[model samples]
Target: MSLKKLISIFFLISNFIFALEIQPTMFEQRIDGSGGYREFIVSNNTNSTLRYKLTIFPGSKKDRDMSKWTEVSPKILTIKPGRNGIFKIFVQTPKEISDGEYDYTLSLKTMDLPKLPGETDKIASAAKLNFDFRLNFIGYAGDLNPDIDFINPVVSTNANGKTVISGTIVNKTPKRGIYCAVNVISGENSLNYSEIRVPVNGEKQFSVTLEPNVKKSDITGITIRNLENSDIILKKPI
Candidate 1:
């Protein structure tokens, strides 16, 4: 191979080798009338030390800001080779605050690692490649009163010959959000369909497919229940 080609390949390999790894890419926390906190684990898998900066931002486009209620500890973290570090996130809800669901994105970005003396310019530039990891954080506050309704559920078949149910989940409550599983019952066969989260006073469209052997005519009812509390939010005949 040509010398130039070898150098390009070397830089590409180095960039891939230094990427960061994080655990629990997505997490949810419930802050009732009282406040609560959560933690995430970040590991340094590269050969050299790793430095990262943690920041919080609104997770959804509709969310304007979350800094007032959400807090992250140790914004800057350093981990030795093969070592792990922890990032703690805390959410505080005042008593006057309304009950609802809030979303935030916890982002960890790698700082530029120092280059060794006498390193080639090309290698140094490649080593400057930084990696970013983001975790979707969902926070719920106040009394947990989630009202979910299944609307206009229809059964169909997908290209894979699996039974599919399509519909919308409406959260009627003005201050509560719900994350739950949709269960479709057909006589003696009960199939757990899709799991979804509907924000406060919002509705979300969902489609879930069952096994090929599950027939559309066999589906008799659909029920939605809270995953955490197993509370039945809505049930309807299909």
Candidate 2:
């Protein structure tokens, strides 16, 4: 997809009732000899004290579990109102691991501010909007894979009120997951395009959004391909 087409696909409308501000929504890089460490800054703006818990999830259950190789310092932390804190995460490379790209999700979830220690808050407060933030990790261990399969695509509106071509993407490759652009088509004309990725040997639901100007009735197909090689990986009519 061209730069113009790429920008058109991610026309997102965010209605975030936010409380905690986290920086660097996603991380993509290679792990150096020192360690592949990342730091995220969190700012608590709400009146209540917020506790964030850090957890890592593997991209695909079918592939090797790399979640165990990650280290998150201060797995759970408490930040008072108007205070800022940081969470550091780094990869602890395992022995004899495959030199390829690895995919994982780092999630930060907020816990309730109880009135007392070791006590649960029974009363719900709507003013404090608890949130779960998912930060994507696309770490290049050394290299990666390019296999992808698009399945069962259909037109739907996402939670953010965007029109999208929803479907499943399967990374059937044994060692590496892929991140790439998806082209939505109405016959030969490219309707719009969006990005998607699946963990190595794992499947994930995808929503390749149609640009606001495109009519839903006109969408007829989905395309996944290698732009560099002009290779069509999968092209299916919805």
Candidate 3:
């Protein structure tokens, strides 16, 4: 190939290699009426300096407009090669806000710099290779009074041939629900314990396998407790 063709291929490959990277792509945050904050890191993995603009928008599962209550510092960032930038996010929730989960997206758009007049067409084309990185953020706010109930508890075997005690937890309250512990007892002895979380007014399915040497008939009772205070919320007999 000619020198120009070789140069063109080099620019194409280089542009693909010099891409941006973000850490902790997905995260969840709990925000009371008092407001809360989170931090994110953006790194420029390319050899050349890069410019980025940050913006917060509603995520696909957004039940309410959360952007209005969100504050992002340093809307614009410039980072050198192998350098990282820090972004701080603050969520301010009003006291009267209803109890529920809100979803939002943090977007980082790479700004494409203009090419010099004498730059080759291939190099200029490569400069247009811009990218956008997005992170999903779910924030929960307001009074968290999650009421959990267990439904249709049963013992079954999974494809892996393990005995599983499957059941569902229904959250009747509007607040997010977290399961601190699940206790299973049989013949006055504890069988299994598990921890899980459930969304506000949502239902979460759970499965816990019995230990070796323990049969389905071993379980006599079951109970679930809240994570915060370890208060028993649900109890039933097997």
Measured by lDDT, the strongest candidate is 1
What residue pairs clash in candidate 2, if any at all? none
Please report how far candidate 1 places residue 112 from its true position, in Å: 4.3
Clashes of each: 0, 0, 0
lDDT of 1: 0.72
Per-residue lDDT for 179 in model 2?
56
Best by TM-score: 1
Query: Least lDDT summed over 10 consecutive residues: which range in candidate 1?
Result: 118-127
Q: For residues 167-216, what per-residue lDDT tens digits would candidate 2 score against the true structure?
A: 88887756656555678888789876655556667988877666676667
Itemize residue pairs with steric clashes in candidate 3.
none
CA lDDT for candidate 2: 0.65
Which has the better TM-score: candidate 2, or candidate 3? 3
Which residue pairs overlap in candidate 1's backbone? none
